[model samples]
Target: MPKSNVKKMLFILSKATIENVYAAFIMANGARMEGIEAEIFFTFFGLEAIQKKKLEHLHVATVGNPAMHMPTMLGGLPGMEALATKMMKKEMEKLDMPPIGEFLEILSDSGCKLWACKLAVEMFHLEEKDLIDDLDGILTIGDFYSRATEDNTQMLFV
Candidate 1:
């Protein structure tokens, strides 16, 4: 096969649900594995993935998730979300997927840039200490866009 033209991948994660967070993580990791530059911009609720305390407690979105094959009412029941999150975590463990905290470390060690959104940090009243140690730093949207100024760079929102 011919070599891929893509040189870099930029991912914007705006959701905190475990599934959405993992999607961005997996894709960015894949890009780095292929020797492509990768970066993740965490904004809105996505910041939870990079928070020191919240990362470990991220849960699956059981309610209103049609893929769960359950009624919305059933999903809303007490403990349903916890149960679903538990099951998902078990499956992820089987697949050798690391938990959020370790995964962030791996991404950082592998040279995948992790940036928190400046506006979101301010809105959430978060200090730098509130974020994961692996985070590169907080950045404005314009600063993030400037990182994408290379040819064959691609951006994705998750």
Candidate 2:
């Protein structure tokens, strides 16, 4: 496709939780597969989704999240989130979806850009080394705004 025809998409991830991360990546990869330019900007708690240590441990919230359908009381039970995470992973496997680690590699290989927030890193006491090595690097909100404000860029805050 020509530069004049490229479609740009920006996904803003604000939650550190599991379901949100999955949704963001699913959308980003879908856009890339459709020949649309995609960039996922991780800010605030969303940084946790990219952290090497916590990324794999991400679990969908069982409660307090309106979509999960579980009672709020059940969500507080010990090990419930872990159990939910396992269930989710199992379902993903059945669907042939790659694990989180492999999924990140897929995004990178597919030309989907990944970036973390500079302010979030400082506030969370995290260094660049803490995130996946494939990252494009930390981007300032100002930087994101300028790019996202460009012509034909569609921004979605997940």
Candidate 3:
């Protein structure tokens, strides 16, 4: 690990939850504002957070999510997640937050690096071409671990 003046903030996103992705981006941006080198790694369902086709359709877990205070059984109900997603979007809009894609674009422009997981891409049969254009790169778990373990690199999973 190389000694540096700035810290590396690594956020590993393994879910597709709207809140998770939003929080990661928000934090990454915040870290950059403080002069940190921040990056977000999208893996598993989290890949949906960066996929071009799934960005706007992202949703919060409506049921079986302790945060939502709903029972697990309710998660099986159709359209609940969708309903929650709509409500969340409306609330965010009221607060003047940009849509997911725009948020990503702003983050990218702000120098927040974005990466996708290699294994997850193959497991989910995803094509790199379908992801947003500004991603830093697709990384294997081993490579990610090595980089994340560098001195002053803090790994956060959401």
Candidate 4:
């Protein structure tokens, strides 16, 4: 047996919320920068980030989150999710942060693998056409575990 120099990381993202989705990308990109091999498997609500049909529906929190406060009840209305997302995007832009889609593309281009969970796809009735084109493939949990079994590999659930 030989020690492997490369580190393998499996990131499981299940939340579609803005911060959670962004955090997944941040971690993936960071891992790549550290010379680690990283794979992200989007499942459940997290699928929205890679699904063309649902990508635009991603949202941020303007209210009810302990860290944030809504100035008025109207600020927390049903349509406010979009507003909050937009506001957050603008703030990120000002900070020169990469958009979620662009960040994912960069990660793929840099050799980090992206996968959509097969069980989630079937459960949501999602077809291949629904996913972003950058995904390396659709994988089952067993498939992911097989890859993550290598020495020094780390698995994360978010």
Candidate 5:
């Protein structure tokens, strides 16, 4: 491709939960690997993925999610969310996958732009101190769109 034809991507992550955040990380990593100029905009629930206070509290679903089936009785146990999340992290470690925090860090280091939505941040009462240090800045929807409108830039809402 010509220099001007380089691919670009704008990832809008609207869900801050574990599964969704992981998906966003994977997509950003993949886009970077393909030489795309990638930007990740965290909004609404998605902001949780990048928030220092809530990042570790993310959980994996072992019950209601059809893709995963924990032992029926185990599913209803009191500490199920914590247990499932721990188990999932262990599994990921066994596969040599990076933890979510480190994954985000790697992407940020590799030139992926990370932004938090200003409106969502205010709505959630989140200050800049609440967000992970790697965020480039906070932006409005219009600011995000202005950057996303570049040629060959793909926008994804997760």
Candidate 6:
């Protein structure tokens, strides 16, 4: 593989579904493992992953998700999302994947920064206390942009 020039990764997560959140988390974790600096900016529905009360309760978004391979109507039925999420979690557990909260802690302890989008936080009427203890802070887009002062920094919207 060619050596990567990228030294930093900035992820903007805008969805709350377990799949979307996991995508960001896994990429950030991979970056850290590769000695790259990494950060996640939680925005829109993605803030749910950071919310103290909601992170553990995140479910797979079954409805209207083509990848779920179920009819939209069936996916929207009561308990369908829960059943899918439960099955996914069981599979994750079998692979020794840590739960959301634990994954956040691991990322934090590994020096990956986690930030909540200020606008989204305000829109949701959430206080700092409502977020995980590992959160670095809430930031505006400008503030987040400033963090990429070095060369070879990459931004990704997930």
TM-score top scorer: 1
C-alpha lDDT values of all predictions: 0.96, 0.86, 0.86, 0.85, 0.86, 0.96
Which model, 2 or 5, shows the larger lDDT? Answer: 2
Better candidate by lDDT, 1 or 2 = 1
Measured against the true structure, the TM-scores of the candidates, in listed sequence, are 0.98, 0.91, 0.87, 0.87, 0.87, 0.97
Q: Model 5: per-residue lDDT, tens digit, 1-158? A: 54546588899999866788888888889888888888999999889889998887888766666666557567768888788788888987898878878888999999999999999999999999999999999999899999966677778999
Instruction: Report the C-alpha lDDT of model 4 over 22-59, residue by residue, as the tens digit.
Output: 88888888888887889999998899999976775678
Error of 4 at 145 (Å): 0.7
**Per-residue alpha-carbon lDDT of model 2 for 1-158, expressed as tens digits?**
54445488899999977778889999899889888889999999899878899888887788787666888898979999889889888998999988777888999999998999889889999998899988988999888877765578888999
lDDT comparing candidate 5 with the true structure: 0.86
146, model 5: CA deviation in Å? 0.9
lDDT of 3 by residue, 18-94 (tens): 88888888888888888788888899999998899998888887766788777877865898888888988999999
lDDT of 2: 0.86
RMSD in angstroms, all models?
0.7, 2.8, 3.8, 3.8, 2.9, 0.8
Clashes of 3: 0
- Residue-level lDDT for 9 in candidate 5: 82
Which regions of candidate 5 fall more than 4 Å away from where they truly are? 1-6, 70-77
Once model 1 is optimally superposed onto the true structure by TM-score, how far is the C-alpha of residue 121 displaced, in angstroms? Answer: 0.5
**Per-residue lDDT value at 69 in model 3:** 75
lDDT of 5 at 82: 82
What is the per-residue lDDT of model 6 for residues 69-110, given as tens digits with 9 covering 90 to 100?
989999999999999999999999998888999999999999
